[model samples]
Target chain A: AQTVTQSQPEMSVQEAETVTLSCTYDTSESDYYLFWYKQPPSRQMILVIRQEAYKQQNATENRFSVNFQKAAKSFSLKISDSQLGDAAMYFCAYRSPLRDDKIIFGKGTRLHILP
Target chain B: GAGVSQSPSNKVTEKGKDVELRCDPISGHTALYWYRQRLGQGLEFLIYFQGNSAPDKSGLPSDRFSAERTGESVSTLTIQRTQQEDSAVYLCASSSSQGSANSPLHFGNGTRLTVT
Candidate 1:
């Protein structure tokens, strides 16, 4: 079984600043996928960024990037130039490369953007 | 629809009653998933269906919860003798292909179920 952990329950960042949300997972599989999902008050899950375990280079999507340390079993999400729209509940997820492709999610961290 | 669609955006039912939640995945998507989200918590995988493959119900919390997907289209999650703890938001998602690490999931707004 794979378990994702987000130590921070809540986080706040000032507008236009940068913020990093930590995530760690325990998985025995050598090949897998890591993802960060954002859910606003609307309760819609949106993909933020994703990282492949086999890739040494981190994944970057515009202002959202990920720091993936496979050896340490750590995958963190970084949001640069944070805006009010970035305020949401962020979740770290783990998915197997196998056929099942079921995602296991962390408890989540509520992000707040301050003006 | 252009995206994943879940029916009955909100449902209220009495405890011990059976409820069914529907999900309409994006057209041409081969993978569909069901997840449960409790208040202020992350999503928990409930079931998954990949094309014609047998569905994975390993994540289901109890035998009372069951789900079925017809081919690559609509899916329904049924909870029998629902309990108060079953109250939560049920989310449905679909992906373009199976076992594609780069494919991101498209999610629906989710059905908020309240069992009183």
Candidate 2:
């Protein structure tokens, strides 16, 4: 079975600063996909970024980027010049077509932006 | 409509009662997913359907939970003899294709189910 883990239950960062959220997963397949999702108070999940296992380069979208270390099975999210809107619950997810059947998600990390 | 739609934005039911939640995926999306989120928690994948492939119910917590999708359109999740623990936000999402590129998921606002 494939499972994702987000060690940090909650995180705080000052506005205009940078913060990194850690994520690790256990999967036997080599070809897969990873994603980071942001869930606001509205309970709407917005995709932040995604990385493919076959690609060595990490994925970046605007202020959000991922540090994907396939060997370590670690995929972390980095937010640069964070804003108040970035404060939300972030979830890490894993998916594969050849291995597991459904997308697996971590417990999620609640991000708090401090002024 | 333009995005994934989940009906009955909020549903409150008594324990041991059966409840049904509906999901309408994007018009041309080939994949649909159902997830359950408890308070302050992450998504718990419940079921997945892709085109004409057999649905994956491995993530379902128990036999009491079941879901069905007609082709690539609407889907409904049914919980029989629901328990208090079943109270949570049920989210539905869909994607045209499950890939790493620009194919990201489109999610619905979710249905808040409260079993009292």
Error of 1 at A23 (Å): 0.6
lDDT of 1 by residue, B4-77 (tens): 99998999999999999999999999888999999998888888888745456778899999888787799999
Candidates' lDDT values, in order?
0.91, 0.89
- A5-111, model 1: which lDDT tens digit per residue? 99999999999999999999999999988899999999999999889899999999999999999999999999999999999999998888774556788999999
Residue pairs with clashing backbones, model 1: none
lDDT (Cα, tens digit) per residue for candidate 2, span B1-116: 78889988999999999999999999988888889999988888888788645456778899999988887799999999999999999999988774523366789999999999
CAPRI-wise, candidate 1 is medium
Fnat for each predicted structure, in order: 0.70, 0.59
TM-score: model 2 vs. ground truth = 0.93
**Taking candidate 2, what TM-score does its chain B reach relative to the real chain B?**
0.93
Q: lDDT score, residue A103, model 2?
A: 78
DockQ of candidate 1 (2 decimals) = 0.72
RMSD of each: 1.5, 1.9
